[model samples]
Target chain A: MFRPFLLACAMLTVSNLTRPGLQPVSFAVEAGKALAIVGPSGAGKSLLLRAIADLDPNDGDVSIDGIERRSVPAPRWRQMAGLLPAETGWWADTVGAHFTSGKPDEASLGQLGLPGDALDWQVARLSTGERQRLGLLRMLMVQPSVLLLDEPTASLDEQSSAQVEQLLGDRLAAGNTIVFASHDERQVARLAYAVMSIRDGVAEPPEAVP
Target chain B: MSQYIALSYWDVVLAAVFLAINGGLSLWLDLRLEKQLLIASVRMVVQLLLIGIILKWVFAATSPTITAAMAAIMAVFAAREIWARQERRLTGVWGYGVGGGAMVFAGVLVTVLALTTQVQPDPWWSPRYALPLFGMILGNTMTGISLGLDTLNATVHRERVAIEAQLCLGATKWQSMAPFARRALRSGFMPIINAMAATGVVSLPGMMTGQILSGVDPEEAVKYQLLVMFLIGGATGLGVLLAVGGGVWRLSDERHRLRLDRLQQTR
Candidate 1:
């Protein structure tokens, strides 16, 4: 009976975000679906993702399920629609300190190809690929219903990228909606059910991934 | 008490001769600081002279309202000085209010507490006691608050990515900003801590030295200086806390978002 009415609604809906030299854009992501945003460099893919997360200021209406984003407290909204940026920032000395719930799930870390002892390691010692996977794991720990990822696998090798994609695929199977921006067409074809092309600040309507 | 030795105006003019050496050195070395040195010396003389005259009138009037007004004037100027010292300032009224307001709050609170509980002058708000105590507290509080606020905003600005990352994970604004706030407060407390440590050994504090010069017992002067030090330490800590708290508030919003746009580069 918890939000029984909103069960039928799209997981995420964004409408009319206006930017100079950028077309007004709007779209929706259905429950359990993945929408891949493919674009060239300087095409504002990250900007679109940030705007949707409400991390950056933009004129738009963004809603999770049937609830408007503004109606919920921002932190709660962010939890529901978590964003994973290209290069996630780490401030603490150890990786474990970054986790709010503390001591991130060991199974989840293994799924992302991280060792059990990774949490105790200093942040300065982490490789770029490790950081990317760990960042995704950190975001996943919050269990956002809708994941906004900006080049989630940009730094990973083929094996690591496969692991990440496999992890994301599991989340998808579990009914979480995903909106990801990537330069990798192969990743788009593998993961995204639908695709949107961003060109010169304009996002074309979503279409089936070829 | 020993007889106070009052200095004539000629004595001060003679002291001014000491500055000529610096001015001469600057010119000889081609450091090009001669003009600045001269200007600084003149400004200091003029400002101190003006304050001396104002203090004389203020003491003669001896009205609480006049005393409060004088304190207010000093606080306003201190606030402006705090505002101007920032590299990336909080925009709008906040740029002025956050640090300025903290300095005034801490300064007034500690000074009043000391006056009432310790000194207990006949009127409690006696101009002679109140004015100088407020001035010392305000000066130290201003430094702590300004340093704290500057550290806070600058660190937040530099660490926006890390802060935003925490926010995205559903952390409340306070949770995300706690580390930086702690760091800022530490920086703010450093100056006062060092000054206190060095008060007797490396340096004779200005207030104690002045008291000794004005025929006060050396022991009495030392006691007063200790009181001043403790007051300043408490005021600085409170001021730093308030300023950094205000800074964190200004940098974030109700939505738990880091609004770095609230800061602007000062010219």
Candidate 2:
């Protein structure tokens, strides 16, 4: 009972982090469940994701499992729950320079269609889609219990997108939680158990992903 | 000590002839800096002349209140100068408090500590010692803090997404901002460090030259210059830390979220 409750505590929950353009938005993603967020462009989808990641300033509560985000301290909470924004941040020039802790082997990189020596490649040289996949791989390296992904696979072609979807599916099979925003209806339908759409800043009630 | 030759006002005015030559060259070269040069020279003369009179009274009276009031005014002006130089300034009171407050606090503290401990003058409030030393420390501190504030603000702007992402990865605000803060502090300390390294090697320092002109023995002047340098170094370090620390505080909330909005200027 205690162990299951503890696992439940690892779920991703969002109350709000508001911008002037956004209304208070809230939702939860239970363990192993993927909540797909869909909206028209400028419906505060990215902003909502940022808020959940505690990147933006807004009034409301976000928690993991049963612990309030405020209680866990931001860094630990973020480590446990990760947010991969639509346009991922690349500060280091080399791919290998990005990850401080996670060192994935050559096979994993190959699986992601990256060369073994790709770690040494300059970030500026990487294509947009490649950067997108690498960003996702880096986040997974942190081994977050919950993932907040904003348009995680938007940049990838169909083949790369399929690989990313497979990787995400694997992550879910491990019983981790994910709240992802995507524009592609098919991706949402394939990945999400529940679908929530943003209309006028607030999330419409979630429905079964058809 | 050797008796140094004194210069009359006419002798000082004789030095102004070189400026006219420079101004003439600027005009002939079509650099168009004649007006600026003329205005700067005139302002310098007027300002120094006024300060000379004020210092005369301050030295004679030797009152703590007067000394404190003068130091306060200088700090306030230094704060304004620092605030004006920042590209990304904290809004409202914060702008003044972080940069200016750090400058004044570090400047006054180091000056007072150095004065009382190393260069103790009679009555302690001797404007002769406290005023000049405070000015030197404050000037160095002002530069360090201004550079620090600019670097910090620029870091927030440049690294907002990256920093925010770090925080999302479960970094404490300090952890998230550590690299940026280190960079800011390094840049802030660069000027003082360069000046120290170059002192007497690349160029003679102003205070050493001034003291030699005033007939102080070269060795004695060297000692005073060293003391002032040490004070300025310590004060600049403190000011830079305060600036970087204050910036870190202003740019983040307790929730470890990066407050990029705080970096916005009202202007």
Every model: iRMSD: 1.0, 1.5
Clashes of each: 0, 4
Question: Which candidate gets the maximum DockQ versus the true structure?
Answer: 2
Task: Report lDDT per candidate.
Answer: 0.88, 0.84
DockQ of 2: 0.67
Off by over 4 Å in 1: A1-10, A16-25, A58-60, A102-107, A199-201, B29-31
Candidate 2 stretches with Cα past 4 Å from truth are A1-10, A15-19, B265-267
Residue A141 Cα positional deviation in candidate 2, in Å, after optimal superposition: 1.6
B94-131 in candidate 1: lDDT tens per residue?
A: 99999998888989999999999998997999998999
> For residue A15, what is the lDDT in candidate 2?
69
What tens digits encode model 1's per-residue C-alpha lDDT throughout A1-210? Answer: 011222332488888975554577898888878999998988988888888777766777888887898898888888888899998999899999888744565677888889889999899999999999989988877778899999999999999999999988877777788999999988999999899998999889999876
Winner by lDDT: 1
lDDT of 2 at A113: 81
Clashing residue pairs in candidate 2 (N, C-alpha, C atoms within 3 angstroms): A9-A65, A18-A58, A75-B170, A75-B171
Model 2: per-residue Cα lDDT over A1-210, one tens digit each: 001212423577676556767886767778898999898998888888777766766678887777787777667777777889777776677988887656677777777787888889898899989888888878777778788898998889988999889878877877878889989988998999999999778787678866
lDDT of 2 by residue, B120-196 (tens): 89977689999999999998999999998899888878988778766665668997788889889998999999999
